[model samples]
Target: MSQVQTSRFNHKKYQSFQQSMPALKMENRQWPSNSITQAPQWCAVDLRDGNQALIEPMSVAQKQKMWNLMVKMGFKHIEVGFPSASQPDFDFVRWLIEENQIPEDVTIQVLTQARDELIERTYQSLAGAERAIVHVYNSTSPVQREKVFGLDKQGIIDIAVRGAKKVQDEAKKYPMTTWTFEYSPESFSSTETDFAIEVCNAVINVWQPSADNKTIINLPATVECAGPNVFADQVETFCKGVNQRENIIISIHTHNDRGCAVAAAEMAILAGADRIEGTLMGNGERTGNMDLITMAMNLYSQGIDPEIDLSIADEVVATVEECTQIKTHPRHPWFGELVYTAFSGSHQDAIKKCLSVQRDDQQWDVAYLPIDPRDLGRDYQSVIRVNSQSGKGGVAYIMETGFGINLPRWMQIELSRAVQEYSVRHSCEVDNETIYKIFQQQFVQANQNFEQQYQVLGYEVHKQGEQESIQASICDGSVHGETQTIHGQGKGVISALSDGLHKTLGIDFQVQHFDQIALSKGTNSQAMAFVQIKINNRKYMGVSEHQDIMTATINSVLAAINAYIDAVQ
Candidate 1:
C-alpha cells in the first residue's frame, strides 16, 4: 500500500468541513434529571484509541494486560483494536480467544473499514471468541467525496451496505455465538445530519435490529464541532429521527478537541444515549477520547453509581503511562497529585472548620468541596496547606491535628502572622516536617543541663522480680552547686519523681498519663513525651524531648514539677 492509502485527510479541511454546521455554545450545562437511567456498560476503546496514540504502541503482552484490566473493571463490551490495520492486533485477538483468556461474560469488538478483505480478516480474528461484535464503519460526509476519498454519498452507502451484508453472512457460520452489528458514520459530527441519519437508517434495516438485542448506532461527534450541549442536541435529534427506536442502541463516542468530551458525553446521555465509548483519562488520538474514569467518578460524587470500578484508576493510568510512555498530568481530575491539595489560607480555613463540624455529625458541610477525598482513597493531610493565601484557622488546625498543641486565640493570631510571611517566601505547600520543626524552634528548645529548678539529668529504675514497688535513683542539680543523686521507690516513674521531690523539698504532685511518640523515621529518631501532672487537683502539662523514651518520660515529669513551682513562685 502507498503512503497515500494510509494517510488521513488534512486537518485544515476537517475544520473547514465543520463550518457548514451550526454555531452553538454550552455556557450553562445542566446535569441529567434521572442519573439512574444512565446506562452502566462502557465500551472502552483503550486498546485501539489509547494504544494508537502512544509514541510506541503497546506490545501484545502489554495489550493483554490492558485487556485484562478492562474485563476486571466490569466492562462487558471492549473494542480491542483495529485488527485489519496491524498484524499484532490480529494476533492479539486470535491469541486471546485461542488461550480462553477472553472472559465468558465479555464480548470483544474489533474495528474495520467497509472493505471485503478487511471485513473478512476482522471475521477471521474473531473465529475463536464465543461472543464478538463486528464494528464496521464508512466515511459518509461530503468532504470525503470532494476532497479525500473521491467517493459520492451513494458510493459510500453502497460500500456500507456491502459491509453490513458481509457481517450478517459471517454471523451464520458461528451459530452459537451472538453477533452484534455496530455502524459509525465516520466524521458524523461535521457531516450533514440528514445524510448521516439516512446512511445509518439504511444499515439498521440491513442489520435487522430487534427489541432484545438492538444494533448499536455509535454516533461520534468525531471532532467535537461545537459545545457539549449542542452535541447533546445533535444526539437527541438523531435518536428522535432514527427509525425503529426499540431496535437500536444509540451510543456516543466523543473526542476532547475543545476539551468538552466529558461534558458532551454526559449531556448526550441526558439526551438519550444508551452507551458510552471512550478511553481512560481521555488517552487517544489528538486531545484523546473522553475520560471514562473522570466521567464515572463525576457521577459517583453526585451520589450516582456509575457501575464501573474506578478505585484502581490511578494504577491503570500509571501502567498506561509506563507502557505507552505518556505522562498523566499531576493536576488531572480525580487521579492528579494536587487535585485534593489546597494551599490557600481561606480554603484551608474553611476545610478545617468544615472538618471540625463534620467530625461531630460524620457528614460533609464544606464550601467549594463536594465529596470527601477519602471516598476516593485520598488522605486528609493534603486537603489544606499553609501559604500567603492561608487563614488563621488553617494554622490552628495544623497545630491541633499534626501536633497535639492547641494554641490560645492570641497565640493563634501571632502564629498566623509568621505563617503568612513564611508562606510568601516558600510556595504554599508547607510540609508536616517543616511545621513540626518550626513549632519546636519557636516554643520548645533542647537544653544540655537544667539550671536547678528540679533537673532530671538521668534516671534508672529496678523492679525486683514482680515486687509491688520500683526503686529509682534520679540525678539532678543539687542546691549546694553540685550534682546530687536521690533515691526513692514508687509504682512508676511519675510516682518515683514525686516521692524523690517530697523527700528533698517537701513538694509533691500526682502522676498522670505519659504520652509519647516516635518523632521521626529511622532507628535514631527521637521520642517526644507529654506528661500531665496534678498538684492539689490542678492539672499541668509539660512536654519533653529525648532520644530515649524512658529519659523523655523522666524529663517530662520533672518539667511538670518545675512548672508547678514556677506558678507558685
Candidate 2:
C-alpha cells in the first residue's frame, strides 16, 4: 500500500480574509520629531476594567483594599468603576462616597455608555462624589457601526451628542458636586479619522468646556489592530483636527492585543496626549491594558519622575498577586523576583567588579543592569547567583557578600572548580549555604580518610635574638598512635612550626602561600587564615578560623598536610 503524503500548510486558504489597515494621510507630522520630556497625567483604571476581567471579580472588601493601595501610591485620578453596568460596581462607588474613603484631592471617574438611562443611573451613583469625571462612550468605528450597532455615521454622532447632553443635564441635579465630562469614540483606532474628529467636536460643543472646566476627549484603541506608529498618527490627526484644543485634554486608553500597548501609549504622549489611563501591571480585558508600572519605570529610567511612588514596588506586586490570584511572571520588568539576579558567568563577573568600586557620585553605571536594584529596596547580596555557568569571580562574590570570606585571587579559581564540579553533578543552582559548606569541608575540615592522621595538639612561639623559636606538640596517626614533641627555630612562628614538623615527624612540605584577615571588625573578633603548600610535587589548600591568629595559622597548615596525605593514600 502506498503511504499517504502530507503537504505544506495551505497559506492561500487565509488570503481571502486578510485585511490591512490604511495609514493616515497627514503631512508634517510632528509626533515623529517630538520626545517625551515630561510625564503625562496618569489615571489608574484598576478597580474598574481590571476588576471586571478577573476570573472572580473582586469583592467590596478586596476592591477597597486595592483602592486604598492606589491612593497610597499617589494617584490623584482613579476610575473606580463602571457604576451603571453591575450592582457590585455601583455598590462600591456608593460605599466610597458614603464611607468617605475617597480623598479630597482624588477625582473618581466612572464609565457609562451613550444611552439616557445608563447615563442617568451613572450620575445617580455619583450623587455625592467630591469631584467626578462622567465618562461616556459610543461605538464609532466603521466595523463597529456596520456590524455591532448597525448605525450610519450620523446615527453614531447622535449617540455621542445625545449622551454628552444627558451627562451635562444630569450633572445639574446635584449642584454641589463638581463634574467633568469625558467622551470616547470607543474604537477610535479603527474609526475613520475625520468622522472621529467630527463626533468628538460635536460632544465638545455640547459640553462647551472652558479654561476653568476642561473636557476629556479619550481615544481608545479598543482593539489594537495596527502598528504603534499608525496609532500615533491617528492621535496626532485628532489633536490637530479637534475643536477647542485649548480646553480639551486628549487621553489615551490602549489595549495590548498586539503586545504594543505601552509603545502605543508612549507614542500617543509624543502625539500630544495629556493623560494616560491604564491598570497596574497591565491587568484588564483580553490582552490587558498598558502596564502603568512598566511605562512609569520606563520614564523613571530616563531620569524623569513618573509622579508615582514605586519604591514599594514589591509590596504592590504582592498585593496585586494576592487580590488577582495571578502570579507575576518572573521576567516582569523592574519588579519580578528574578529580574535583578545574574546567573551568567560574564554577567556575574562584571557585576561583582562594578559593585566593588566606591563612587562618590551616585549614578547607576553597572553593566547588564539598567537600574540599581537598591532603588527598589533590593540588596546586592542576591544579585549574583552561582551555578554550573558561574565563574571564579561569581564564586568569590558569593563568599565575600554572603559569609565575609575574601578568598585570595588564586584560591578563587581553585574553589570555583570544586563548586562547578558539584553543580554539574547535581545539575542545579548552588545556594550560598551550600557554597559555604563546600568551603568548610574542602579546607577547614579534615578529609574522612585522614581524619586522625595528624592533629595539632599545642604550639608556643618566642622571639630569641633575631629569630623566633617554637616548641610544638603533635599526634601521629599510625598503628601505635604515638604523640611527639619537637623544637625548631625560624623567621616566624609558622616557619618555626614547619621546621619543627620536619624535624619531629620527618615529613617535609614547603609553604607556598600564607594570608590572613579579620573575620569581623572588633577587638575580640576572630581571624581566618589561608595556607597553600606543596608536598611531593602536589599542591593543596586549607583554611582555619579562630580567635587567636597564631592558632588559626597552625591549624590551616596541618589541614593542608592532611589533605595532601588523603589525596596520596
Candidate 3:
C-alpha cells in the first residue's frame, strides 16, 4: 500500500485500483454498441441485503409486510433471507413454507456461506418449498484470498467446489421441491477476471447445469472500485470466457461506492447479463446496492415495460422507508417528494408552456419533466410551486389547478408579483391554500379595508319573451347596509341588473372582460363569476362564488364597482 501527501487533502489513501488489481485486457469490448431495449430478469434482495444493512433490522412482521409488497409489485424471484445466519430468519423461511404464503409463480431465495452446517440448514429451511434458489458464495478477490483467508487460488476453488457439492447433495434429500443453485464469487468485480471465471467454472462443473435447469452465476461488484465502462468490460469478458453459456444466467449485483451502481448495472445488462439482483431504492451495505426503482423507471421512461408494478411510487417509497426506518432524501431520484416539482422562474415558465399543449394520447414532451407525474398517481398541483424564485406561469398554474381560478396573462403577472413579495418578506415558499388566500385578498376582494361596501339582498326577474325586467333591493355601502329599492328593464337578467346598478350607484362603466365557470365538477350549481371593468383607463377585476350563478354575477359586479370606488376615493 502507498500513501501520498497533498496540501488540500490527504492524497495518501489513494492510488487508482490499477495498482492493486490486474487490469482487464479486453480491447474489443461489445457492450458499448448495445443499448438497454428490454428489461432483465429482476430479483429483489430486500429481505436479506436491504435488511442486514439497516441500523435496526426489520421485525418478522415488517419482513412479512415487505414480502407481500414485493409479491404485489410483480417480483417473481425474491431473496427472502439468510436462513442459517439467524433463528428469526430461519423461522421466517419455515413460516413461508408451512403457511403456504409463497405464490406458485414466485421462487423464494435464501443465502449461505460455503460452510456445510449453514448449507444444510439453508436446505432444511426450504424443505417443502415448491421452487427456491440456494445462493452460496465465497470471497475470491485478491485481498479476501490473501489477507482475509491467507489462501492460494486453489483454496478458493476448493471452497466453491465443496459448497456446490454440498448444496447438490442437500437438494437430493428434498426431491419434492425444485431447486436452483446460484454461486457468487463474492467481490467478483474486485477479483481478477480470469480467476473469477476459474472459481465459477469449478462450481459450475460440480453443479452440472443444463438448459432446463440453468444455474445463476451472479458476479457482484461487491465493492465498486471502477467506473461503469470498466465494469462493462469485465462483464463482457466474463460472458465470453464462462462455460456452459446456454445453461447459465449471468447476473450482477453492484454497489454504489462510487455512486454509479445503477449505471454499472445497465452497462452490465448490455454486456449480456441476463438477470439483476438489487433492493428497492438501492438499500444495502456501504453506499448501498443498485436501485431497482430507478432501474425499472429508467426502462419505463424509454418506453420499455419494466415488468414490475410501479404505478404508485409513493407506496413504494413509504413501504421501503417503514421497513428500513431510513427516511428517503427529499431529492431522491424518481420517487422523492420534490423530484417532480420546480420553482425556478425559467423552468416553471417552460413547464407550464409545454404542459398547456400536452395531450394524453400523444407522447410526453413536457419541458423540464421527463415523464408525466400523473403516471405515478400525482396530480399537476405540485408540479409548479411558488417561491421567491418562482415566475408568473407557475403562480397561474397553481391557482388554476389548485383552486380553479385560471388567471389571464396580465392577471398572472400582477398576482405573481404580490406572491413574490410575500415569499421574500416571509422568507419561505408559499403553499397552495396560502396562495388562494392571497388571490382572494388581492383580486376578488380588494375592498377589504373599505368601510362601505355593496350587498345584494334579493331580486326578481320577470321574463316576457326576449325582454326582461328586474325589481331588486340593494344596500348602497351605508353604515348598516340601508336598503333601497331599484328597478330597470333590459333584454336579459344580466342587463337588467347592470342597468339597475347604474341607476342606483350614480356611476357608469362598461364590462371589459366577463367569464363564469362551474367551480366544481359534475354540476353547474356552484359557479364563480369573473368580472373586469376599466375605470379611468385602469383595469380592475373582481371574483365571486355562490351556489346560484345569478347571485354570483350580481355580487361580482358589486365587488368590481366597490374596488373602483376605493381607488377613486
Indicate which candidate wins on TM-score. Answer: 2
Ranking by TM-score: 2, 3, 1
In terms of lDDT, model 1 sits at 0.76
For model 1, where is the 10-residue window of minimal lDDT? 442-451
Error of 2 at 16 (Å): 13
Instruction: Report the C-alpha lDDT of model 1 over 183-204, residue by residue, as the tens digit.
Output: 9998777777777888898898
C-alpha lDDT values of all predictions: 0.76, 0.88, 0.89
Model 3 TM? 0.85
lDDT leaderboard ranking? 3, 2, 1
Estimate, for each residue in 1-569, the C-alpha lDDT of model 2 and write its tens digit.
Answer: 99998777877655221153467777789999999998899999999989988999998788888898899999989999998989999999999999999888899999999889999999989998889999999999887889888999999999888999999999999898999999999989988888999999999999999999999999999898888889999999999999999999999999999999999999999999999999998898998998999999999999999999889988899889877878899888888888988888889878888888836387778887888888888877778888999888889999999999998878888888889999999999999999989888876764323645666678778998879998877776753557778798899877898898888767799998889888898888899888899988878877888887887888788778778777776
Candidate 3 clashing pairs? 4-12
> Which wins on TM-score, candidate 2 or candidate 3?
2
State each candidate's clash count: 3, 0, 1
Q: Which residue pairs come into collision in candidate 1?
A: 345-389, 345-390, 345-391
Top candidate on lDDT is 3
